[model samples]
Target chain A: MPLFFDLLGVFFFAVSGSLLAARRGFDIVGSFLLAGMTGFGGGIVRDLILGVVPTAFVNPFYFIPPAIATLLVYFVAPGVQRLVRPLLIFDAAGLALFCTSGTIKALEAGMNPFSATLLGVTSAVGGGLIRDVIANKTPSIFDPHDIYAVPAMMGSGLIAMLWMLGIRGWTWELGVTAVVFALRILSLKLDWRVPKAVGPWHHDTQLR
Target chain B: MPLFFDLLGVFFFAVSGSLLAARRGFDIVGSFLLAGMTGFGGGIVRDLILGVVPTAFVNPFYFIPPAIATLLVYFVAPGVQRLVRPLLIFDAAGLALFCTSGTIKALEAGMNPFSATLLGVTSAVGGGLIRDVIANKTPSIFDPHDIYAVPAMMGSGLIAMLWMLGIRGWTWELGVTAVVFALRILSLKLDWRVPKAVGPWHHDTQLR
Candidate 1:
C-alpha cells in the first residue's frame, strides 16, 4: 500500500515538473529529466546525506514511472492543462505522503527527531526548489505567498510525536497526512501569509 | 594570494557559465543565476555533504564576483567567446585547487581516505554537473569524449597519499595541482579516451 502511494506521488510530481519544463519550452529530453528530478531529487539528497545510495538510483522502477509520466505529459499537455486543479490536488497529496515517508525513513535510520523533521521538510520541498532554480525564479519557499514548508514540518512533526506514543500504524500516518493536506489547502484558500515587517534595516537591496 | 586565485577562478567560471546561457538565449537573470551556480555550486554541495552550512550563503565576496562576471558576459558575449581557451585553463586550475581543498576539508571532518577522495572528486566536478543538467545536456563526465572526472581523481588521490605520508604545506599541494592541470590539458590536446569495446551493447539502436 505504501509502495502504491509512493508511485502515485511520483507520477503527480513528474507531471507538475514536466508542465513547468514545458512552460520554459524545453525539449522532450529536458522535460523528462526535469520531471525525474522533481519526483526523486529530494529523496536522493536525503539518502546521500544518510550515507546510503539513493533509492531512485537503486530501484529501476523509480526511474521508469517518471519517464512514463513525462511521456504522458508530452503527448497530452493540451488536455493536462485543463485538469490543472486535479493535478494540483494530486501534487498536494504527494507532498504530504513524501514528507511523512521521509520523516519515517530518517527516524528508522536513527537520526534525532529534529533532524528527521528537517529531512522530511527538505524532502517535501527540495524538488520544487530545484525546479525554481533551474527556471531562474525565486523559490516558492522564499515567497511570502506560499505556505509550503510549514505544512510539511507540521506533518512530519505529527508523525514523529505519534510514533513516540506507540501509535505506529497506517491510521496515524494517514491522519497526519490528512492534517498537512488540509492545512495547505486552507492556507491557500485563506491566503495565509507570514507577516512582513518593513523595518529600517529591510530594504530592497539586491545582494547579488 | 589564495583569495586572489579563488576570485580569478570564480571570474572565469562565471564567464563560462554566462556565455553558455547566452548561447542558449536565456534572459539576463537566467545568465546571472547560471554564472553564480557555476562559480560556487560545487563548494556549496561539498559543504552541505560535510554537514556544514554553505560558505557562499555567508560570504558577500563569493556572490559579488560571480555577479560581476555574469554582467560582463551579458554585455560582451561575442568578445568573451574568443577567450574561451584561457577561461578553460583557469577553470582547470580552479578544479585542481578545489579538489585539494575539498580533500583536506573531508579529512579534517574525520572522514576516511576513500570518502575524502570521493568528496574531492565530487567537489571538483559538481558545479559542471549541475551546469550541464540545468542547460539540458548530458553531463560531460558521462560523455565518452570527456576526461573530466579522471583528472580530479588523480589530483585528489595524490593529495591524500601525500597527507598520509605526513607531508603538509603548500609544496605538496601545488605539485598535485600542477599535475592535475597538466594531465587535463594533455588529455584535451591528445584526444585521450578510455577504450570502449566494440560490441552489441555499444551499437546505437535508436535512429535519431
Candidate 2:
C-alpha cells in the first residue's frame, strides 16, 4: 500500500515535470530526463541522506511513472494546460504523498522525530527544487510569492509527532496527507504567502 | 592520502562557494550553508548513488573546510577579489580532485567502468550545480560559455580506464587530476566553449 502511494506520488511529480518541459519547448529526451529527475530525485536525496540505496534505483517499476508521464505530455500537453492548474495540483499531490511516506520511512529507519521531519520535508521538496534549478528558474521554496514548503513542513512535523506518540496507523497517515493536500490547494487558491524577511536590509538590492 | 586530497578539494570548493555568497551579499548563515553545500554536496551525491553513507556525513573533519571558508570569505572577500580569478582557480581544483577521487571510489565499489566514469563526473559537478541552482544562476554545466563537465569526464574516464588496465597508482591519479585541472584552467583562460545546437530552430525562444 505504501509502495502504491509512493508510485502514485512519483507519477504526479513526473507529470508536473513533463508539463513544465513541454511549456519550455524541451526535446523528448529532455522531457524524459526532467520527468525522471522530478519523479525520483527526492527519494534519491532522502535515501542518500539515510545511508540507503534509493528504492527507485533497484526497482524497474519506478521508471514506469516518468515514462508514462513523458508520453502523456508528448501527446496531450496542449490540452492538459487547460485543466485546473494541472501543474500545481500534481505538484501538491506529489508533495502530500512524499511528505507522509518520507516521514514514515525515516521513522522506520530509526531517525529521531526532528530529523525525520526534516528529512521528510526534504523528500517532499527536493525534486521540485532540482527541477526548477536545472530549468534556470528561481526555486519555488525560496520564492516569496507562495506558501510551498510550509505545508510539507507541517505535514512532516505532524507525522513525526504522531510517530513519537505511537500512532503509526495508515489511517493517521492518510489523514495527514489529506490535511497537507487541503492546505496546499487552499493556499494556492487564496494566494496565501509567507512573509519575506523584515528589517532595513530587506529592500537592499545592491547584490545580484 | 586520499582523505587528505578529498579534504583539500572540499576546502577549495567551499572557498569558491563562499566567495560567490559573499559577492551575492548573503547573510553569514547563508554563506556557511552555501559553503557546506559546495564543499560536501558532490561527495554526498556520489556516495548516495553508490549506496553508502557519505564520508562527509560521518567524519567531523569534513565540516572544518566549510567553516574555514566561511570565515575567510567573511573577512577578506574584498582583498581576495584582487587575486587571479580566485573562484575559477578554486573551482577547477575542486573539479579535478573530485573527478579523480570519485572515480577511484566508484571503481573500488565494483561499479562498471562506464558507470564509474559517469558517477565521477557527477561528483565533480554536483556541488557547483547545487550551489548555482540555489543562487539562481544558470548552472555552469549547462552554460554555453565554457566547457566544464568535459574536463571532469576526461579525468574520470582516464581514471576508470587506468584502473581497468591495472595502473591504479597514486601517481596516475595525480596525473589525471593535473590534466583535468589544466584543461579547466586553460578552457577558462582561452574562452573555449562547446558548440550549441546547430539547427535553425535554435533561435526559438518562445518558451520561458
Chain A TM-scores of each predicted structure, in the order given, are 0.87, 0.93
After TM-score superposition, what is the CA distance of residue B94 in candidate 2 from its true location, in Å?
Answer: 0.3
DockQ, cand. 1: 0.04
Model 2 CAPRI rating: incorrect
Candidate 2 lDDT over B59-129, as tens digits, reads: 99998999999999888767745533898789899999999999999889877787687678878988888
Name the lDDT of candidate 2.
Answer: 0.83
What's the lDDT for all of these models?
0.71, 0.83
Just chain B of model 2: what TM-score? 0.93
Per-prediction share of native contacts kept: 0.00, 0.20
Q: How would you encode candidate 1's per-residue C-alpha lDDT over B1-208 as one tens digit per residue?
A: 5555556556656766776777678888998898889878778777777767777787678878778877887675466457546545656766777787778777777766666776787678777667777887555544445466678988888887888888878777778878888887787777776532111222242211
lDDT of 1 by residue, A1-208 (tens): 7666666667767776766655554545556656766787677687777877555644446756677866766555444334445445655766787888888888889998889998988887787677666655567667777587789989998887777776788877878888888887787778888765465466666534
Going through the candidates in the order shown, the clash numbers are 0, 0
